[model samples]
Target: MGQAGETPGRPDEAGLGARLVALGGLELGEFDAVPSGPAGASAPAGAPVVRTGEARKRGRRRTHLISAGVAVAVLGFFGTAAYLFVDVGGRSPSAAPPPPRKSYPAVSAPVAVGPQPVDQGVRTEDDLHLVCQNWYHPSAPRFRGDSPHPILISEDGGAEVDYRSTRTLNQAAFAGSSAQRRAWAPEPRRAQLVACLDLTGPGRPIRDCTSGSKVLPLVEGKYRLTVYEVSSHRKVVDRALTGADRACPFVILSSVGDTLFSAVKDRQLYDLLRERVEG
Candidate 1:
């Protein structure tokens, strides 16, 4: 009953589809394209669709791979920074540090020698001049006759030296003797001599020398004594003297001579004498 080339229900169907579209429904063509269940059975409306297992697995793998790459990049940056910090700023292993400084006790002033003239009986060489003298007495009775007489001597107007007389002589006789009498003659069997340079300054002389325990026959020869600086306990002088020097004076008086003579080359004796003299 339709006209040629016209669909029988086409116009009516188009109008109904337009009316549905205006009501916010799907287009008729789109609605028909939605798949139905098995054998084209219609599914229940408004149901949520779940994703497949393979799709979920693929998504998780991509996320994990991206996280691993980020972690690696961050670790590499930190490692490079740490390496630069040590290489540019640190000290070398072979470099040595400075040594520590040493300290010492303060030194006292030099001792002043005598204004009195040395005894004329005391023998002297033309090259030497006597400056000062000191003596130490012996503590033990057996050593009473043996005393130390430290005589300060100047050579060629240079620094002072200590010439110690190791002898037992009568002080009164030696002091009172005239030039011709020769009363101050030292006993050859009981006399010897030793010399050392005075390291202590004026008024602070440190006498150091060495001698035999018992008197030996006086053989004219050179004897050496090592003198030490009292403050630092360091050796300052090593000197020698001859027994034949006539100007080298004998210690006066047996007891006084003994008191003045003990400290030479003897540490205990030196300490005792220092205590008594200083105290």
Candidate 2:
């Protein structure tokens, strides 16, 4: 049997060449025939090559999948961050209190007391001069006629006024210097004035006692002096004189033995008694 255009039963080389030329329409080409036996024929020369088109397409598909996965991961991270920020922003802050204000004092009504008569010519320390004067309510407490009165000294710049009870204790101390027992304190719990006020004005005149003080010459004996205001209340003081004239410059009102001190009785009685007392 013949294989394709091969000559069978004849090992004729010319016939094989002629068959090859007839099958391929070649112009009597010369070729060497490869012999096949127990030993196989040698393979054709040159290296084997694979096409790259399908491999390049598969690599591009893998790259696209990886990029999509990275994009999804980045988007999830950003969304989670935004959700946490919103949750933290939903809480509140703290609350606080208010402030304070300023303050002042209240006004009061004027007191009820009569004015005093100013004696301008009543100057010189030798004569008893009335520099200042004041008054108090009759119902006000009074320990004695010589107690501190509602009278302030202009020399102290009108800052304070002594009540009637305080004046009494001070004068008593002065008078009690020669007594058997000097007064260390005021008499315990006596009827005296509580408060006093100054009712003097600039129009009123005062005797200037800027220089020497007054001296009242008296015999060695004990004498009592009573002081009266415009009303009936009186203050009396029993003064003892051992030596010469004493400077009784300021008036001392007292209520020692009598119900009313003479100076605090009526103005006429006080004037009459003061004149009779012989300087």
Candidate 3:
């Protein structure tokens, strides 16, 4: 045992070396020198290197996983690029967006607004006229629902230009003690008084503005009214109506007419209408 291995020169050295050799392992600090591996079997003989079946399969699987990951990454990159550049749904930035529809806040309940001013005009409409199809004429002391007035229409109101001056509701050139007209409607030549809106501005009916040829179905909205005294072109009354108030677009016009009429100049009629409506 003495010279068969490297010497442990002293008795104490020999005893300590025997004890350490018997140990399975020793606890070590991070910076402590590590012992070399136990003496091992040498590589197999003739071919100089060898691989087991399990090791070969593990290497193949690792290669396959790397290839699959690369393919997925490539697909993801191109997909993102297509999404950023393509106009998938044909919507283009240059196309003008449709105008937003107008909306009005509903009043707490259907109520009247004013016989106030031309700037604050009443607007009423439904898909089709029911109660509102006609207008009232105090001169005739009756109401007619016919639009654009059988008489007293704007010069630009209809295609009746050929017979504009001569046409009447009936076949002949006739006289009517009663007449039907709207607020924006031009007054009869004989009316002598003008609508109140005539002084402020003209209210263009939706029917008048868009087509001007045919009677369009009424759309949902408030209907506005204004009146003018024909001869002096004096504005008698103008106001706006919402909801139920829309039932009578030019309700004030008749009362206002009373103040202007020579025969029935009831001055309180205009004030009475205003009080009722404004309430």
Top-lDDT structure, candidate number: 1
Tens digits of per-residue lDDT for model 2, 1-279: 546743344356447546544444222212232222111324346522221335434544655677688999999999888777666665323322333555666667987865444333222221111222443223323333432432211111121333222222343335444331122222322222111212222221222322234322222222223333312133332222121223332543232111111122123222323221211
Q: TM-score of predicted model 3? A: 0.19
> What does the lDDT come to for candidate 3?
0.30
The lDDT per prediction is 0.34, 0.31, 0.30
Scored against the true structure, residue 62 in model 1 reaches a CA lDDT of: 61
TM-scores for all candidates: the values are: 0.23, 0.22, 0.19
In angstroms, the error of model 2 at 21 is 53
Better of 1 and 3 by lDDT: 1
**Which stretches of candidate 2 lie above 4 Å from their native place?**
1-65, 76-157, 160-165, 169-193, 198-209, 212-279
Please provide, for model 3 over 3-52, each residue's C-alpha lDDT reduced to its tens digit, 9 standing for 90 to 100: 55343455454343244334422223211222122123244355233333
